[model samples]
Target chain A: MTRNAPPPADSGAVRSAGSSGSGSSGAGRPGFLWAVPAAVFFGLFAIVPLIMVAVLSFASWDGLSDPEFTGLDNWRTLLDDPVMIKSLWLSVLLTVLGVAVQTPLSILLGVWAAGHQRNRAVLSAIYFVPLLLSIAAVSVLWRAVLDPNLGVPAHATWLFGDGNLFGTQATAIGVLVFVSTWQFTPLHTLIYQGAARAVPPVLYQAAQIDGAGRVRQFFHITLPQLRNSIITSVILMVVGGLTTFDTVLILTQGGPGSDTTISAYYMYQKAFKSFDYGAASAIALLLVLVSTVISLIVVRLSGYDKMRSTMEGL
Target chain B: MRKSRPNHLAGFGSLVWLLVVGLPLYVMLVATFQSRPDYAANGPLAFPEHFTLDNYVNDLNSGFAQYFLNTVIVTVCVVGIVVLLVPPLAYTIVRSRGRATTTVFRLFLLGLAIPSQAVIVPMFFVISEAGLYDNLIGVILPTAAFAMPVCALILTGVMRDITPDLYEAMTVDGASPRRVFFQLVLPLSRSGVSTIVVFSALQAWNGFLFPLVLTQSVETKVITLGLYDFQTERGVDTPGLLAAVVLSMLPILIVYLFARRALVQGLMGVGGK
Candidate 1:
């Protein structure tokens, strides 16, 4: 069960410390031999193209000429493109809904489940089944369910008014968000549950002795203790939200209009559908930059690097 | 000893939440057995009057077997390459000392920051130029490449848990580097390796976007694309489409059922919480 838990003592430090263990000349000389095959594969596939995407973001070639460079033209298109703007706004809305709305609900359910003696583990597994299933599958299942005429709840016509929820622009993105939230809430819960279980029992005991109720102890002790977990989950959810493609891709394909197009799908559409690789690369670049920066900011603001070095000092 | 708080309201709330999450899946399962006539007449929620295997039989006959085979091959190859490739890389990152080696590790760490979804733009060009377009090899190469950063990261973290004394003892005894790796590091890193295999397999199996962009033809289709195209082709055959969906999903679901603890724990580690 402890198969992959990171060492408690500043995992970042562990990397540096472990690296330095081979400081002597003989030890240092032998192991670079090992990193080569992987480095080659990674370089060819991951590292090179990552750099290429940045460079090619400006190269205007519609699968025709050999990618002639046109500086900032693709980016300029983004400024004028309504779909681009709509996609950007939708991405932000999705991320915000995930971070602000869904995460708190995950923590709530996670904490509630944690208090149980049995069934917690079983229930948690069932809760996360949606997460482990293919998003394509989830989208189809939900589409069928929300299909108004064919969906199960369509029989209970009174429960859902005008049941074709995916047909409208307003409800489409909202339903997409709901489906993603449904799938992921359990993951967040599991993360929170792990963090909650890690909270020492003595704190709750001490709070009880002082006559504090569950709510008081939760706010005064549990919430503060969970600060790092909360931040971790939020950044993760945001990153997930920003790059989310499958849910929207399968669920909407940026329709009943380009209404549900998040940036990821928008980039896909630009490249494959519209055959505009340059603009697609620009969108892809912006998306990675935005999401990566947000995660980095979370790391920076959380003082995790500082905490790592501080833990190393001891 | 700690006082336990009985929050009865939360208990009720969690059950409600459970039903809300469970209902759609239950509906999907019920629909998998119902005929179109039954489905249309009774609607999606009601129990199937006739539990039929006709949908699955027809679905399998309609080329799901090929899709399943492609998915199996892709997932297996990706996991195989990753499992073989990452341990050595993580070990080298852990045990090697030098500016070059450190840079190698840092580049890998940077891979975590690079989203594959974004990288797919240039990857499209790269894959096409390599003549791997509409090739499962095209899918596998990028999939393995994207999986490395996290795979290497996880293995590095796990590798660091090995004591320096273990390596020192092997080295001082004049054991070859390869000898030390095989005899000492590999066995210790088994759990870490298994965790990443499952993680990467799940990622590859569920991957929709890469397959969407990179592979063009039916011969190269992965499960994600297969399910998408199958559902659309089947038109109003919800049960058949869902039968295919369930068929596509069963492999990973079975894997998850057995490996849930490792999957969850390893994921927690991956998240670095």
Candidate 2:
């Protein structure tokens, strides 16, 4: 893709030429030397592992011993397996549920917190607690909090009159989504709050002068202004949720008929449990495809090209 | 006609929202104090009639002190390395935009795409060969390397936001590049540096797949590994487990308690930009 592209802007070329010009004449040799370690580090660690993953994905063998030539076999298995197909669907479902739940909740909280700058610090602290904790801690915390026999849900049922409030498959999925949102919303809230705060107070005042109520002002002034952050946070959450493991591994382990077994969990089981490295690599490749597609969609929907060019050039 | 007072719906809504958000945290804290029977019998939110420091004391005996230390060591080391390494690279990228800089950053961006799950198996072989297989540094090095991309990406965004004129003026005043970085850029980018700290800390602390798959011995286990041990050894001990969790969360919680505003500000600045 880069082959046919125009050269980078003339400014960079001019800068490099000027640096080289100075170095040849022995005027500005000091600055050029400092950039060496960074370039080398990036090449060694970042560049190499990526090429390795691509190479390994096509070969066949367990992670131990030697890998043999097996072109297209892994990819072919991914194309045909029904379980693989189902997990893909489940991964998509998790992403959708997470994004659907988190985006609006975070936007609302962000708007509310931004509206009251006095309490913003305290409110942000409260919301961000989950984000600070690890996924393991979150899983364990929720496991204890949601334990059917000994959890808060049981007590809530005692007060509200209960049988089994969360034993159903839908409820199980709902709980996972809820935990994900709890972990993520504070982050998006902060993003939106920043975006909302950046919006001129004059805009809100102007709307108020025009008799726009808070609700109307939110739709008109807040949501539109926060489009970029909202989209960015949503993309991050969706990508994360689809690939989620630690929480599910701790909470459900994809239990009750494997209802919560997203592609990520399925991939782990297939690779490690079933000893199907070929299948796992295929699944990994497919995940990359799915992520790439989703990211492309986000880029298109958010007009990220325009955003990047506009934001980066200055 | 008498006009009614302003509607209190917004105030009422916010109060309800706050309660909804705060209730789960209350449950976690409360659960840590109650005995197993009390927790099992009364449900998670019950006020413990017999409040106990026993859970905390028992946990201290449960081999978590080492786990906590390991977690701290790994997390501090990862964050320290990432902060020290990523900025110079990111600074260079921001200041000197060219084929080489962009190529390096794009490689880092690939790290963003390459999930740890994909790399876990190969990484095990790599770490074991380095004789760091069960060492804390084993987990530390790979996690830091993998995290470099995102950290560099965020730092580059921040460093880019600094006005180039500052760098130009410093150079004219005979400050070297490293001097300009330490004196002018680093201080100016305090928010960005703190953002990387908060971010890298969460990544290292929360990481489970690496530590779980790579490390075997108790001496190398971090908090996530400790929790896994909690699950296996005392799986039914509700209060003990919760106590351990609360203990695990304490350090980051303390950091967040003070700097959440900075974190939010950082997210807004780095992420949104």
State interface RMSD in Å for all models: 4.8, 6.0
- Model 1, B8-63: lDDT tens digits are 87878878888989898888889889888998888887888899998889878878
**CAPRI-style quality class for the chain A–B interface of candidate 2:** acceptable
Candidate 2: pairs in clash? none
State how far residue B14 of model 2 sits from its true place (Å): 2.8
Model 2, runs deviating above 4 Å? A1-47, A158-167, A292-314, B1-7, B173-175
Can you tell me which runs of candidate 1 are displaced by over 4 Å?
A1-30, A298-314, B1-5
Error of 1 at A102 (Å): 1.5
Q: Which digits, one per residue and each the tens of the lDDT, describe model 2 over residues A1-314?
A: 21222122233343462364323221111232334565565555444544555666687878677887688887777768776677678778888888888888888877767765456556666767777778888888787777766676666766524534345667778778888887777778778877887998888778877888768988998888998787788777877877788877887777656777778888788777887666666666666666666665654664422323543343
lDDT of each: 0.79, 0.71
Candidate 1 matches the true fold with a TM-score of 0.92
Q: How is the predicted docking of candidate 1 categorized under the CAPRI scheme?
A: medium
Model 1: clashing residue pairs?
A: none
Each model's TM-score, in the order given?
A: 0.92, 0.88
